[model samples]
Target: MYVQIDLDGPAGTLRVSGHGLPTVELLRSPGAAPDPLVPLGTRDPARLTLTVDGAPARIRPAKGRLSRRSYRVDAIVSGTRYRLVPCSYGESRLTRDGRPLGTLESTGDGRVDADWAPGATPLDQALGTALAAAFGTGAQPWWQTAADLAAELIP
Candidate 1:
């Protein structure tokens, strides 16, 4: 399966194309699963105009074979970043400028909790931990903590 994810950013745009999507439930729907793709471009996903202040944003994928829940997305409401993960029962971690910042782990009932590094957080820790803790899931994304997470991890 193949999918295309486009994220709008400030100044320009961020685009990612790849083989699959993240297993985080934040992307899924109440009863759907969508296959996500990682953009092979030299940059991370694009940042959109959607923010905490803007209206709800939209994510358009190439296909819908995956669960609808897998395609669920939410804007941070403040920054130019938007989150795409399983919605009903998944978790997600975030990185800033390619650095791990924090994570959002799902509690399995459509309520994902967050846990970022006091300073420097890991990109794929919360998602990995949530999946493991919930369903013994196994799939690692190149996660790393950004300077913020690193600050917490080291300092």
Candidate 2:
């Protein structure tokens, strides 16, 4: 199944909609601060929450080192763990318990395309797509890019 995530919704909102799935609205928030001891370079572990059919789920940065080139975000829906691992490109893979659930690709036009596996459930479709949209699928902010460049040059 295919779904499209619209990032151009009202500020701090992401809309996920497509065939075979109900429209879901994810609310974005800068939840809590990352652990000071953990090394997250130029990456903000923002939090996202969404409710689908009265079931609420939360997505947040997993505990680990998040750098400019790689990062991991996680969401739990109906007791199933979904992880989104994004690469440098405008692409990300959605995994469930280490198994591939789907793929999300950014079109660089304020939208993301999500292709789901054959066995994915409706909740899986909604949550996975929302996670990818909330995590973002584009180049880093200019300030962050510049800071990373400066850090590399200083060493």
Candidate 3:
């Protein structure tokens, strides 16, 4: 599972990708703490790859950086791509095109919450709506489906 977030302003391109077999629990976690890299749906790390904008970036657990569960993804993107990576996730955020938007967060409880602060933009609102549609309200277990695999862009 992954998300390509394009933000406007000085922020850069930001992407959230799940290297191994992604689970509802893993994705929904606020990631308040870093945990050891565990292979998704297996006892070992699942071999995976992501090619963004024609460049391949490997995603894996940090060796000695286990304290930080977040994988270190290479930032090979440039230009506007770099400007959308740090938009604050909240209401009233602007899109890369400078549109009014709102930010949405997925609650571990299977509910999608959206905060609409002042100056919110459409991109933010679209993200919230997209999350609810993509992740849904519970463990839909769609990843196991054939359609899900293709949708994930797994060649």
Candidate 4:
């Protein structure tokens, strides 16, 4: 199933729908700076809740200080942990217990794209991207972006 995130204007939040019914609302903190794109420098992270069948999966955002990482959302399902990490080329990686599981990429068409590894599921990847869109805000460069740009234009 595909995940759709609607920019909820009045509520100043995002409505994510997929893997279930009606829609799941991802609410930014009231104190969070409101913007269609959450700023790269901000410490605030969004929140989301998901339910499959009869169980609940919590997507909670956590800001990092030592890593200098802006934020990470941990989606825990039945005690299993998953994390979102902003990677190269405006892409985010979802990791399970420190292992690469999947990736979410933003395309030129203004749509979110997801690519999963061997065993990762789409639902978890979608949830990871939801709170993990900081885009390397507080982290260092991943090198790929720099190399790509340098290769494209040789001055």
Candidate 5:
């Protein structure tokens, strides 16, 4: 199955479309923390709460640095775990229990293309598309980008 995720909509909105998967729209609530680091001069990190098809869902940074080579975010929906692992550039891999599920590639804009493996369920398509829309890019918050650069220079 092939899914397309558009993140360029209004702020905090994600639109997902695919052949076998039902179109899903996810909304992000303000002040939900998905990253460990808070923006500079901010008191708290921004929290991320996504509403998937009118149901609340949670996604958070699970491992690695967002600005580094390896970074991953985990989202659980419908009792299934969908892992979005970012690779070089604007590409990401979605996995479940160490099994390859799909590949998400960003177009350097805000569009992402997701190609899922055969036998993937609807839940996988929806949640994987959501995860890719949320974190499939190489972009990061300005503060986080600066911090990463500083770390590299100082190390």
Candidate 6:
């Protein structure tokens, strides 16, 4: 199964879809259409677009290296780079400039969980949850979505 997710940014609304839909919860957010002007190329399994932003960004392993556990994600948001590094305990950590911001984890029951560090914002939690769900899989698509959604959270 697949899911589609949408997020709001400082510039304008960003939409993530394709594969074509049903992974993310429509209960959480309704998606917007992607702009045809900017091309995302063909490497990603998911799709995203921001109303007025830089050229398309790429999702790569943190530090440009592979991991034995899972791929820790890294990307630039609004030109600011952010890393979703893995914690020693098996969850992924989203940190900027070495400051802890949030944690995203996979529950054994097929649900992905997101927990914001103290002083985190709603967007942080939402992004973390979306990141967590990017790695999730199951019969239901509620918590399992595409990496494209995770990439758009940058900025």
Point to the candidate with the largest TM-score: 2
TM-score-better candidate, 1 vs 4: 4
TM-scores, one per candidate? 0.28, 0.64, 0.23, 0.57, 0.63, 0.44
lDDT of 1 by residue, 1-155 (tens): 23232332121222223244332222222222211232211111132122111233333322212343333343332233433343233345444334545555543232234555565322233233323222211122213213444667774
lDDT of 2 by residue, 65-140 (tens): 3353345777666677778776545667788878898778754344557777888778677767766655555334
| Ranked candidates (lDDT, high to low) | 2, 5, 4, 6, 1, 3
The TM-score of predicted model 4 comes to 0.57
Residues 28-145, candidate 4: write the lDDT tens digits. 4455554444432233434333443346666655654333234455667667777776665367678887888877764322256777788765555555545443322224463544
Give candidate 5's error at residue 134 in angstroms: 2.2
Regions of model 4 farther than 4 Å from truth: 19-24, 30-68, 107-110, 132-155
lDDT of 4: 0.53
Q: Which digits, one per residue and each the tens of the lDDT, describe model 6 over residues 106-150?
A: 532234556667876443444444444443211222223334456
Question: Which is the better candidate, 2 or 4, if ranked by TM-score?
Answer: 2
Candidate 2: clashing pairs of residues: none
Worst 10 residues of 2 by lDDT: 34-43
Off by over 4 Å in 6: 1-58, 62-70, 107-110, 136-155
Show the lowest summed lDDT stretch of 10 residues, model 4: 39-48
**Candidate 4 positional error at 9, Å:** 6.2
Preferred candidate (lDDT higher): 1 or 2: 2
- Local distance difference test values of all predictions, in order: 0.31, 0.61, 0.28, 0.53, 0.59, 0.41
Q: Which is the better candidate, 3 or 6, if ranked by lDDT?
A: 6
Candidate 3 lDDT by residue in tens digits, 38-143: 2121111233222333454332322222221122111112221111111322211223334434444442222335546575433333333333322222222223
Candidate 5 lDDT by residue in tens digits, 106-125: 54345567777987777777
| Model 2, global lDDT | 0.61
Give the least accurate 10-residue stretch of model 3, judged by summed lDDT: 77-86
The TM-score that candidate 1 achieves is 0.28
